[model samples]
Target: MTDMQHKPNGWNLPINQMTEEEWKDYFECRKKYDIKLSDEEIKKIIKIAMHFIDTDHDKYMEESLKIPVPPNLAISYKAFNGLKAMKKFNLSLAKETYPDEF
Candidate 1:
């Protein structure tokens, strides 16, 4: 299908349905040569990422019957948030040093 076929309104498509060549083009367009998210935005993204981590971990256990949950199958929200915050902070620093990369 042509790229236009995937546009719901303005050219956004479901990533899973993208053809190889179309996906390549999409990535090319998304290549940010000089864009850095603000600290606030990065923090928000990390918070969202924590939710995904929890979801995927549960999904994996459900899918793999042989896998057993540990006695303490718990994740510390505080620690994860802290680590994510630090990671985003570091990414911002790297972006400053290499002002021409994603």
Candidate 2:
């Protein structure tokens, strides 16, 4: 979020954990910028995300317990998944849009 031009107060905190003031800031910040995804793109993300959750997540969690400190696995996993989705989406979109670049 360091790269964000506008971010809510306590953006690092989970939505349910946020204060009312932070929620207000969040809504206001949301109005400042938007990245609209196509319906197909959204569906693509959903499919990819669900596949990970259904197929790989259990194994990932099982393996993670081997580590003494997984650094807030719930939050870390969500963030990692989000970044992974973004990277996959970007790579896919970029490849289709700029085939020559690859």
Candidate 3:
């Protein structure tokens, strides 16, 4: 198997090995900047972090879904999938909403 095959979705971060401090850091970074880490972004980040936390992916995802989407943003089904999926759907939606962005 290739390297990607050994990794979850070819993620680069070692999230499964995070310490409590790192977990706090992650949230702090997210909150400090008021970053709207969308569902997709959050999912990817969680996958990486969970790798560091050495937790179950399904449990992590389930727990994450309960966190709620950011205010003022509507989540498309595509975002629930992954980055690429969300990109395609988001791009199309953006075009539909603001053709000028295309």
lDDT of each: 0.33, 0.37, 0.37
| TM-score (all chains, Cα) for each model | 0.29, 0.26, 0.23
For residues 6-102, write the lDDT of model 1, one tens digit per residue.
3212122232344556555543433322134566765665565565665687544323322221212212221233211221122333334332221
TM-score of 3: 0.23
Off by over 4 Å in 1: 1-30, 57-95, 99-102
Sort by lDDT, top down from the best:
2, 3, 1
Model 2 RMSD, rounded to 1 decimal:
15.3
How many residue pairs clash in each candidate at the backbone level?
0, 0, 8
**Model 2 TM-score, all chains together:** 0.26
Q: lDDT at 97 for candidate 1?
A: 39
lDDT, residue 27, model 2: 44
In candidate 3, position 86 carries an lDDT of 28
lDDT of 3 at 84: 26
- Cα RMSDs, all models: 16.2, 15.3, 16.6
Ten contiguous residues with the weakest lDDT in model 1: 69-78
Clashes of 2: 0
